[model samples]
Target: MGDVIRTVKVKLDVRRERCDDLHQTKDQFLHCANTTAEWAWRHPDEYCVTSKQKAETALYDRLRDETELTANLVQKGIRRAIEATKSGVARLKNGETTSQPHFDAWSVVYDKRSATFHRDHVSLSTVNGRIECPYVLPDDPEQTPIGEYLLNEDYEFRMSTLQYDRSSGEFYLHARMRRAEREEHEQSTTAFSDAEHRTVLGVDLNVDGSLAVTSTGAFIGNADEMNHRRREFEKTRGSMQQTGTRSAHLSIQSMDDREHRWMQNELHRASNQILEEARDHECTHIAFENLTDIRDRMPGVKRFHAWAFRRLYEYVEYKAEMLGIEIEQVSPAYTSQRCSKCGFTHEENGRSKHQFACQKCEYELNADYNASKNIARKLLKRLHSGQTSSSGGAPCQCALTSGTLNLNGEFIASVDSTAEGESTDKPTTSVVGN
Candidate 1:
């Protein structure tokens, strides 16, 4: 069976103008309530109210004559207030801690001088194209007048409505504004097949401008462009900080925003490219370094490392999911320092940035390649040992053709060339961090 997926969204504080309109609507409702109460007192036999609904209907009729506010918005406000009250009651029944009951929507009332809305006690209902809130309205001289309140300025508008499918017994709310457009492409629902059918691709990212992939060895790419832009931004920000001028501050802010947008886009593109290449090669599983603990391990300059590590992981996961590729996280301990050919671990083994020569086994290789090989080996071991959740689930291995390798006896170097008889050149080796 396929897994169930759902998308949840929350929209917070909206415009204040909508809120003000709601408040004014409430004030008109109270004026109607006071008139009804006075009529009921003078003619008790003719205007007898048995239920709250009766009073609410009367209030709605009176309010409709006084204001131009739409009936839909007023009803929506009343329904929201009632829902809040119901939610509070449910929480108390579940033995949850809660505060005292407060009025979710204010009721409008009229006095000799002006109209006002009181938050204490109010009954709301929708009738005859108006919202009816029948309650005793407060008449204080110090209180702000309802006529001064602006529509959509003090109150925000929210819509909530339920739709039910009788055939499927499914019910859901079709509410909230469309803030962002949804992608048209349908997502894949197939679960990943067993271990034998999948090949895991491990990727190692570093700040020194390199990307190491387990299956294809190492490639060069980095946040160097982002770093350069950031440096330029910092200079502008420094000048702005010294000047304390409005124009300089605005310029600095604009530059910072531009830099962030560019960097984020670039990172997304690079991560997606790498994942697509792996999928094209028939690798269904992807592995990455678990960088959560890296900050504690390396203390100083923690903020920089945290940002880079999080951005890389987020991009990889998002791209992998979109491509229907499964991702795994492996411990990053000693992946760079250990020898790939032989199982030897030593701090001095990696003497330079680009070179790694194991002291115990005397095996030497490019630093990035060594790390890639280690990552791949670790993933394979985990899969074979049944330590992974998706292990032993399927048996669909990809068929790969063998290639010829040219060996350089001088440095014990080996290079694999394509099947099309294309010649492979050895890379110029340079020692870094000597």
Candidate 2:
């Protein structure tokens, strides 16, 4: 497998007297970044300074003379500005309204050249000079948070960001770490190379209580809690906006960052849970509903909800790729309304908020779970169709906890119904198709 990059955040033990030096360094870095961003923002027509090489050539020496930041720090600021410019340009091209990127946050990016890691202390470059600061690590490595990422030999050190928490008056270093995938993952991938032996996991994203539901009967995240937090943020922002004070505006920015971090943390947890569920089910691939024109389908969904869905998918996509597992997207059509057991399709089948009951077969299950199974079946059908045309292979079959579904048009389950229509737990075959 290939290398995987992850970030670990650790609190720093900085002397109160030395904290001012770091603050000054952060201020200089912000000034340099904003200066570069302002210059790039002036070029609306040409969309210039989006490239690292062009940005360095145009603003590197100028920032060095204008700010007190060191050479590496100035380069990092330029890189940050270029990334923002590129994002802004892309959004504008997509007909989205966006303003020039601005950096008001109190954070500084540090690369290997500007930072040194020791056993217990880290030396960082500041405006004054290099200062050595101790890490707030526990006595035992196992007791440390993200200890594997911080102290493991397998992880290689990369760039980091220095951030100050105003609420706690603490300095934190978010260290980016890289490591290769485990050998077992490679072996497992090889075992799944045969299409006949492959298993797939399907996930359904929703804005209800559950954020994601997997075909293997696993629910990943809490959408209700996320929506509650979003509402709280909106209420607080509205009150602060009405105040019309500089401190209120600054508080709004800090609150926005906190909310974003919290949302991202939730999404990360959800994505990790999805990966675990896939592994638990021995799934070689994970399938999700295609998100194209999602807004048109679910017009009531808020912008942040759509953003969360996209970000969650991205997190899962990368994590799955690291383990050599493939990700697939299938058409979302009729997934919510179609019955997983009988393949009955009707709009009224999804009448209930949390439960789904097939109008034709009386099949009942959780709505999201039913949709997830349909997503899996759709992907299986698509894959099998291609395989049949190309290699004349056997039909695609996926094993559920209680049954096996053959994409050739039948579902074989261990459970069956008697003459009176009561479940008898006997083997039977059901005709199931799109």
Candidate 3:
């Protein structure tokens, strides 16, 4: 087994007094970080001379005295900023564009040495004093204990960031823990699971079918009720915002939190279900469209909420990694309208938003289903050719159309958009990493 990092989010159980203290300290920590980065940015000459250790050593005393933050937290903030500054300088040296990393008063980092976790409570050091907060899982109300990994004695606690969202009035502690993980890449060598035995699950995602269509013939994520609830919330938000009273505003905020959590919970369920499908079928690889900047190209009726598509892709990515399912992003061009039956591209082939009919041949299929097959074909080409770049396919002139929707049909909700893991060209097996 090798090292794998996992982030366990446990809500802080601090009362108002301690919570306020933590918030105040978080502000100071952010200010200290950004301020230090600004210093490094202005003094590029000194950057070459000063190592991260030297920069941190010079800033620690000044930051602690000025910001009233503790030693460890101040040092950590400055160290983080130094790392950012170093990155920016390197980018400039390489003739690449660079921008300074900026931070504000919303979140703070807590090094492993700065906190202690017990069975139920965690004691954290701040500028004021050591505050103890029992962690809480946001959606789970029954006070169910945190995950077993968090409590595992052998797990290494590296560092975590504590952030408070003003809109939801919730505190989140993202604790990153390290454990051992190892997987044998023996599929190609195994006699039972050779080229013929390998299963490639190609998935095509679209607004027409929120549930993705797969090459293996399964549609995932049919949560129309979720969409209905989102539309209702939007309508309610529109009506409520008109009143504009303080109480009405507060009620709206609470409603927004509920809607956001509901959407997140629902999407999590969908991601899990998708992973279960892969696991059950022993899917070795899952292929998806490289939907990076998809909105810029086709801002049409067939695009779902951008956040939903992005979040689903990200969630599926990490979840797939956990199940040892490899993920790759193929070219988005021709995935939607290209005919999988005969590789025909005709405008009339996509007869309707939901149906695809080929003009050259009598081939017909569900629009999304046809698209999924094309995605699978693209993946197969990559596999056989040993190419890693995006597929170099011509764009389809035909467009998938969806009927117009009024205000009621639109889904709107403010939600958490932080991707759990950082994007990487070289994929890693770990669940948590940047």
Candidate 4:
């Protein structure tokens, strides 16, 4: 069977007015909670049985009577609230638990503080005969520019963003656009065309500041820089907690925002670099570990784990697609402890902060690099062997080349191809240290 190829691009545009209005809407929804609570208290017996629609209608009526909100706006707000309740219920049934069930959705009603509607070209669908609702673009326009470019020209491009310096009144896009053509023979399908063959590169990322590249037999990069920044952030946070002063709190908040922006930029750069390198190696398919489950492994630190894993995977997947590469995910079982050199399983191999020394085969290497090799090998083996393992160990048998050389006096040249057929050829001679 051949693969399906589709292109999607995203662009983001943030208007200052929209951002401020969104924030105000959020604040108003928070204030409305007291209204809901007071009503629930007065009619405790009816609260549970009252449908969300009925509750919202009654609340709107009371707000209208008090001149807190206009009748038309109140009705619009109620309808939005009802939709939110339905969404919350659906999410709960799907096993997602949250302390703030209906919080965020409630704010959508107030999203447009200053509503504008276009008559000639209707921008939004009329809701209950009211045209002053927040507009959902025909398609998500924020990211549509890139999608249009990719689809229209059948080429890949890089897309990135930069925030405005509000104090300085400076706006910067900082977009690094690189367009590339896929130099492969195209095959026609029933509905569309397909590439002759595709390459899948599996990536394994770790919070310990290392990224595993399955296709290259190399650790792409580590998060040491990020870790350093995080440590600084934590120190500042702790110092602020100790101070307990208003000025200290303000400083801490500023620091937090700055650190967050820095971290986001760094992550974006790292993810882009990874994909760019993969493209250079002619990778057409990109794969990653199923991070949703890997996140569950951190029971107490689930929130942090979820944030890190999701951000990395999301960036990689979207960026890969923008580069005309397909992305997939596989199980993340023992990609680290299993040996890529030999099919030796080291179930009892105790790892330190940096090294993964396999007890069974006495193989030693940087833990993240070893894991990456294992991930690439296992995925390729799965594609070729068509075998499933109940034990959940990463499959061995990646066509990898590795050797240790004495750098004292000899000259050597070598070429090694990974499981995905990515070749690295280098010739070198070494001199002893002076």
Best by lDDT: 2
Tens digits of per-residue lDDT for model 4, 278-356: 6644555555777666655633334544555565665565456447665556676787777644557766652664566
- Each candidate's number of clashing pairs is 17, 0, 1, 6
Model 4: C-alpha RMSD to truth?
A: 20.9
Each prediction's TM-score against the native?
A: 0.48, 0.52, 0.47, 0.45
Residue range with the least summed lDDT across 10 consecutive positions in model 2: 425-434
Residues 1-434 of candidate 3: C-alpha lDDT, one tens digit per residue = 44678787777777887777887898888878887787777544554322555665456546755786665677778877888888877887898877677887587888644677564667888878888888764454344324555666556566788888789888877777776443422432353242333345567776544556665445666646666787799899899999999998999999987886676666666667666655654566667887778788655423345666666666676556446566777887877677765678777777677777778875766677677667756765675455632212211111011111111222111132123211111211111112
Off by over 4 Å in 4: 1-194, 209-215, 298-302, 349-353, 358-362, 381-434
The lDDT, on a scale of 0 to 1, for candidate 4 is 0.46
RMSD of each: 23.6, 20.8, 23.0, 20.9
Q: What is the Cα-based lDDT of residue 48 in candidate 4?
A: 27
Candidate 3 wrongly placed segments (more than 4 Å): 1-188, 191-197, 301-304, 389-434
lDDT string, candidate 1, 20-138, tens digits: 44445455443343444443332214423323334333443234335553333332333333344445446756888654233422442222112122222122222223222332223
| lDDT at 213, model 1 | 38
1-434 per-residue lDDT for model 2 (tens digits): 66688788888999988999999999889888888888888555765568775676567545766776666788789889889988988888899988778998989998666788654668999988899988888666675545777787677677789999999999998888877678744564455354445566788999877898877667779999999999999999999999999999999999988998798889878988888877755676778999767878875578888888887886687567557666778999999999887888999998996788889988887788788888888877776666322122434655454445666556455354123221222212221110
